[model samples]
Target: MSITWYIHRLRAMGPAEIAHRFVEKGKKLAARGRMEGWSRYRTSGPLPVLPGLADNLASAPDRVKQDIVAAGRDVLSGRYSALGADWPLRDPSKPFPPTIWRLDPVTGGLWPGSEAYCFDISYRHERTLGDIKYVWEYNRLQFLQPLAADAALTGNPDAIEAIEAAIDSWYEVNPPFRGICWNSGIELGLRAISLLIVTSLCGSRLSDATVEKIRTILHAHQVWMARYPSRFSSANNHLVAEVAGEFLISLAMPELPLSGRLQAKGRRILTEEANKQILADGVGAEQSPTYGAFTAEFLLLCCFAARAAGQPLAKGIKERLALFSTFIAWLSDAKGRTPGICDDDEGRVITLSRHEPAYAASVSAAIAGYLGTPAKGPRPPEIELRDALLQAPAGGPAPPTGLRTFAEGGYTAVRETRNGRDLHIVVDHAPLGYLSIAAHGHADALSVIVTVDGKPLFVDPGTYLYHSGGEWRDWFRSTRAHNTLTLAGVDQSTMSGAFNWSHKAVASLDGIEDGENWRLVASHDGYRNRFGCLHRRTVASTLHGFSIHDALTGNPDQTTEIVFQLSPACEVEINGQEIRIRSEKRWLATLSFSHPGQIESAAGGPAGTGGWYSPRFGIKLPAPRIVWKGALPPEGLLTNVHLVPE
Candidate 1:
């Protein structure tokens, strides 16, 4: 690890987190029998349940019950799917073997199995086997939902028995404060929420002993989260998830002695963090659309849980939730695909729907259902699940439609109907990220993502991997990875570590013109510090097409490269200065540039530096990227995109 990473962690972590690490280290030492002094915190008394909790569970729509049961059956039959992998569940009745931890589902490579606890293993350092993301996927315990759901829905004693057996096996092998599963507070929070959901679904099917074990695990999770809350710059979506889990545990199980304190603390943290983490315009502070959606879902759960417990959220929080939904609605294309702006792990608060994580429409439907707003597009089954859980009504006043701008969030959307075809363009003119770390932000300051009649043309190459520590990680976050201009072959923001950006580029929206056509002008100072230059981009949309102009303020002689990354589905044919872009076997647009420059295409090669797109985590596909290289004259460079309808 670099000194920058250490300094980042030191600043981002709170005093409690520092203390918690010492305590956890001691416990790990004791577990290995290397230390004689260690202490374990214990919770007193039995777990509590709030009034009407059972009634709320019973009130789930009959359709939801059927879905849960069917999903559970799918899991039991060894057909559970996650992260684009279909893998069979090991027999739940047997103990979970240590070998399962070494298997990387994405690469089909397995590390040498180790009997030592996972916490002691440096999974990231074992680079020979490739990515270790799948290891965390396995530890997420996502399959627990289906098992608990099946146990509850069928009222089958064997199903409940198997569920308890799996829990027992996991507890036996993984102790508190140890293992990769315990490494992240967000993971622990997610597990606590999942356990609560299972408990809610299983109800009377669970044995007293099983319930006690579950409660014990929940108590441990609460303690861990309390000691190591994701705070400071590190507090992005992770903090929202952590506190939401704490809130769910406190709200769902109130009988425990610490429930009241936990409840109050959780609520307070959520309320304050929601306001802090969600920008005034409803964009998540992390600035990734996928993570923004994830954070919204987390908050929605808290909202629903609190309401169900007869403790409604404050009016401000409710309005903020609605704003979040509205922001997503505006950001989504006609097909409901959001621009993958930053890091996306395909993470979900809960898998209520079987739809792929990239399907932003499903998320919008759920949000619309919860807020009682008319959904902007087709509703998915996930929306029904949200309605069933919240008992919220179907329709309300429709949200405002048309072009919108969020100044604070530094995003502008241009939506119009040209030749009876819907056109949408999203422009980014935001900071590198939220705070000191900017952990999830990218270096694409003036990048643009465009869709015509619901088909993506110019797009953002989504984040493929993190912690890989190679060209792949750096390339995905680079300015060249986005639809923007790169000056002197340097990033708009300086990279301090994998997640930290120093000497950050600051972007500002100069002005917006909306009349016969929509126009936006923005500039960034990322190059000023190094090259004594400023990058200014002007985007204008007319009835038939759109144009982008790239200019430099300080140095007109600087050599710059302008890139437009095409969506994976797009096929490009270049003829002279005009490039034809096609998707789904039909021509989507024609691109023309004014400057006499060399155009090159990038597709992945042995070097792994080329045109590639990652629609989901751990999945990369070849894509066409049009790169224009030349010196910037005083007049600057201009590229015009003309939309074509089939």
Candidate 2:
């Protein structure tokens, strides 16, 4: 866990040897991409991606040639990967030597990377090599190993040479032929890699030695899978990979003892997890359009793998999977880019598409192949998958209801649909899967963002960057970043420590009903232990605007203060009546709250947004305080807040 442990391990590890291995592997891949460009889709231009059609298969060889030729041009033009034979080890200017596993705060520490760092690498940054080893299994190592095995299966000496070189290189950065960080990575990676090997070799009647090696690897992966059931227990990508991998290996190798039972359990997990992960409305909880697509693709891949192996995947899994992918289509703009809500806006790359086709292409293709129909109906053209995959969101004919759950994105969006007006309120009730709420999660447990008249009066600052130093990440995770009530001037929960992914509390939608308007009551335990606190936030549409209240309750006598965070540009009006603060270009807001008779008011001090990296710009009520008249009521503390018209 200590830097010294890593350093000592590094001393025993050979950086030069590791560097040589990785460099050689990179060279082989770069060479392959140059030799067979179709494998990496290097030649596809940045628009109208039409390369993966069945018609193209007739001229597959020629296409591959053209691809390689195009890639060769990039190489000759000096526009490809620049690693060559010397990389991290020989690059003395880099922070850590190639073999020595060290964590960059921008990345993570060596041995046991933070859970936040680990989950991001696995689910978000899976394609990239990083301190988080959990990703290696499901993302990189699993997919890469098959290419190496395919070369060996073909009896292609060139590919075998490349495979050997690649494996050697992989081991240098990843010593002991396993991951360096979490044990979960090793368990997951080995399963994926072995499954890849099994599928790659199963298509060919290979030599005895090759077949035996494949079986051994497959068995080893099963052993790892049995030991790591927790990996599949969650509703994330790792669970998907586990189920699919188990099913694939089991069907491919029927004689294995655990294969049948694992397949059964895997199928169950897949079905249940799919339901849980795909929201009632069909969007990933990460609130990321790209992650939504990525998650759907993983589900579809698993579904297909299960079906192909004769495993009876549940009937609704495919439909549910397609629905989630379709949600991605719904959110994408004309250009195919889903709004960058979370992590990477680019989405995850599955194949060599020219542009990231809004990730709708992958789903479209899967639906086309599975449903035996082409995409059509009411969805966007970019995401309109073949007919079979097109299923409308729940409550089809009826317009969607308010406060619908977006399980995939881990938030609840409650909208007010009255007459022709559209008002929206999104609360982060997302599950703690791979995403680290540490920075993205606001301490405002029952914090809410309201968009009245479709304008953001209150908001969560989204995210800045995970690597821009601790202060930046901390501020992004602080209570000040969100629209919520902070008590006693304490900025939500204390944020001085390192980011903790495990420190999660779900904000569940307990009751939602239709009155003359809409009412929402949601709660979370984020503040329970510290203050025996439970924040119950209620929003109801009123005559003009909406009425907001937060009932914070605990024990004993304590003085609690609540602030309704507004955009610095907002023109503030306090109470049911409008009383303006004096300012124009400067920030203005009315501050008032009835806390019994004890409620007091003060002048504006320096209540501006702090945090050096992330600038919370705008006018702040320097020293604003509203007096509470008397003792708090049993209904808890009620603060009526509303936004003023621009």
Candidate 3:
């Protein structure tokens, strides 16, 4: 996020995107659209009954019901802890619910207040404003869903009163088109979903004045989204979320005159974008599984919302949605935890279950119910509430119990039982990311991840920061941060900003086959520009562990650094050419290199480059990383990883 980085980013855009930016800039100058375009239009139709579907929550399990009610009671006490990814942004003080909408609760800084047009606000330039996501999360008002759910769960008039007051307060503080809260389209979409959830669940419990006020607010949001969309390179998950918001608004607030128009528009664009943004194999084009889950949930929930409105999507739409959850099912471990591949803001479309594993289960349940298939795996508590929320039929096939290849998406999962060990390995040969900027992708082409019997060993160091991170962002996103080969000490892809990758590495997956166990053959030309070589790797699975063969096909003289990032659960010790990686009781695997010249284990260094793991967003802890440095012979270099018994 520097001037130079901005220049490179602009230069990276295509002519069409450049033209769109100019058009958007002109709109900004004119102060047109985006919550300021026009007054509330005329009303029409019976106010949507779609939101009434939330009444079904009465059928949800008592455990989930009690948890939601308890969370709601906490909110009633002026504390909102039903937070997702952006938890650090909230103040731990009392009388918190009435806290200023524009306050950055973490830094205690007042964000550019109601006087500033959202267009002119420079969140990146103003460190005092804090991360924009933090403000957006607090302002999203999603925490109110449980309040509304509580009201519906029982005849709790207090929850209803709190929600009405909060809405009235939010509108008064952050007016239309003014302040940082109105800055992004995705924020509007997210808040829209939250609003509908509240209104639908609370139903007649909310005052008529409040219901009409929500209808007006939702209409303004759709007007902004329709006028100024996330177009061109920006059309990733943001677009999906925006359209989903509009679709829900149309379903929940049919009184808005534009409801019919937006419903049609939302469905068309969602269907089109679903095919465009999601691979045929069901992986999100963004290359980040966390973001993938976020996107899939948006589309999936929107699909359900449409159904609840008595408007089902095409058969193909549900088919593609099935694939989405299937990929998520495969990526997740035995504990329902899925490792982050690229960036993870911990973006949740809605937070019924605060726990990540439970969140995964709920999404899995929704997908299963929609398809009327058996669930991918055993689920934790709270699935009943999610099933109630989606109104989907419950079932999906279990996560694969054997090697599975997603050739089109460039991912291979080896999830199976071998030699009495439940081994799970996720290999990445995917290109940087989805489109031109490859926004969420890291320079981690041809990297590898391994979990033996559900314990992480070789892991992808999760995304620790975005936007505010400086050198830390670059370091965590580099080739050096992943379990892959680096030639001449350079990343596989070039990054200009936290979200922008300038030069991208083209990764090709040669094959995924079974011979001696399962093997994956892949290569990337990331270093070919500088070193004139293609980094080719062949990962062959073993009964015990891995037989990895690496080679430089185009050029052979460059020195290579093969890094293996270990899980924080692991303890590493090395002697000579071999390294032993272990957890609590015993070593999980023994690792060694072919013709190693120099090797070292890095942890808690002064530079802070290695030995770091981010369990969640905004948190990073020290973990060991093994770096192997040497030149391979003209022939090749081979690595052997043999499993150790407990």
Candidate 4:
């Protein structure tokens, strides 16, 4: 066979050396033991069905199988084929296509799409794979294989021939099988593998050459799986597939030379990757709640497959999946929406639910199967409390927490601290997964969103997407979008560049104590990205309402204007006696007053573009960047009252 030629050509490593690599890795895993709840014993072949396997749900028996069949036909027949359009690239042949990789229209810098597409897709898709791992592929294989086998068992020569021809056509054209350095090609190869398995099962005639080709492809896949040094050995969702694919294919073809020890290496790599990548907080390193759920689902599939194949189901594997399943469930709200902190696929990636309720049900099913816990009703606080249990070892400074409002990693959490009487502060800072903050970051770094009662007099204008229009992008990242001091003439960072390096309005709420009226002192570097320095302070008045104090330093002569505009969801009222603002969504009302300190301007600043800034979901807006500007007085303070229900 030509397999030796390919394997030796890539690296002259002998089979012994490759096998040794796996053995060494196994020893390292053994050293870690079960302290981290990782099991060293690995599995091969179809996973052993657990004790309650009969109770396991199979996504409603593929009730939409006909729809899937129709869709499959459409895809195969090139009907409704917007393949290139759906992707930013025109062709898969090109590396880093210009659509996602080009000079920014504004900054003259390299576009962010290249990094965005790779990171976002890999991270998010892997999350989906987490929950559905190989199930989609395997289930589809199971269906197609049996159907093909039946056709062959009967005298349906035409059906068998047609399936064989399709498999051959796919294999002939697939880029990886042909010599191409494409990631999508790897995915396409997976598709081809599924096709071949189905065709072979259907009593199709196969030449000796075809069987050899299958062996070559499987070997190629294994080589691809092990190419990346650290990757093949890690314990993340990616490793699960990378290793699981080879293990499954090898098991299917008993003639392959893969030894039990060799297969154990791949499984070891899977476990190791999972341990390091999944956080004790039950959050994936990638940090999107949607992806978190994705990861859990796929891993469950892996465990199921392992157990069914008679391999040992690693210790704590099910618990980890259950934990993350719960985390995603907890992050979801009544609306079944998470903070879009990252590129959430709306559940379409893994063919899961799109909205919250469906996702809640899916999670419940997974949890019930794995944890035997009830899947419905309000989530227990233990979900949040258990976050502490996921913390990395001692002396590793605790992962960011005590946040009042932080949305990153496709999940947003808003907190209202009542540690002190009538004191309130909100913080927002979460890890950024695959989402772009190029337009949504605010100038109010460490800026606190304050309220007196149930009114939101001062706030950060919740951003909606970048493509809504240019005005939306510009305005959403402008000083006006946040509750902070703005110089009348000076602008925040130019809205021409991606938001990765750009400043975001965030706060540190680790050491806040409730005393008088709620008081939070936070800082943001958004303005500093342009002007050398500028600082603003917002204080909730212990007496009447809330006031924002402006402290300006750089560009002293720079005309400054301080406008306290209410957020879109806020109800605003301005009067001589008091200003009241209220919001039902946030369930808080606030009054805001700002003093134009050492700053003066007659004409309000230029209007910035405004709108939502997500690629996955659709958003609508009325006008472009909205603005309100006025004169500023030296050392001034503006006050607003927030009314919160007593």
Considering summed lDDT, which 10 consecutive residues are worst modelled in model 3? Answer: 81-90
Q: For candidate 4, lDDT tens digit of each residue in 356-382?
A: 323432443444444445542233221
Q: Is candidate 1 or candidate 3 better by lDDT?
A: 3
Per-residue lDDT tens digits for candidate 3, residues 280-319, read 9988788887677677788887877777667877667777
Q: What lDDT does the true structure give each of the candidates?
A: 0.72, 0.43, 0.75, 0.38
Runs off by more than 4 Å, candidate 1: 1-4, 7-66, 86-98, 101-103, 107-126, 129-132, 156-162, 352-355, 358-361, 376-378, 381-387, 391-401, 606-608
TM-score of each: 0.89, 0.53, 0.93, 0.50
Clashes of each: 5, 34, 8, 102
Q: What lDDT score is found at residue 147 in candidate 4?
A: 30
lDDT of 2 by residue, 1-646 (tens): 3454333333332565445545644643443322221122112111111112212222234433334234323222212111011112222123223333333222333432222222222322222333232222122333333233333234444334333333334333432223333245234433443334423432243334333444554555565555444331133555555565665566556567776898778678878777765665676544444455555655665565555545557887777766664554443323333323433323232232112334543454444455544432123333221111222121111113354555435555555544344555666555433433232234555556654443444544434444222354555455544556555445545442322343555566666666556666776665676667776677666654466566766632444544343433344434433333323443222334444434333433322242111111111223222323344455765444433434
Which runs in model 2 stand beyond 4 Å of their true positions? 2-168, 171-183, 186-237, 248-265, 275-296, 308-311, 319-412, 416-422, 428-444, 451-457, 461-481, 489-511, 524-534, 553-646
lDDT by residue (436-530, candidate 1, tens digit) is: 77888899999999888778888888887776546787888888788999987788987766677766799999999886577899999998877
The better candidate by lDDT, 1 or 4, is: 1
Candidate 2 lowest-lDDT run of ten: 78-87
Task: Give the winner by lDDT.
Answer: 3
Worst 10 residues of 4 by lDDT: 384-393
* Candidate number that wins on TM-score, 1 or 3: 3
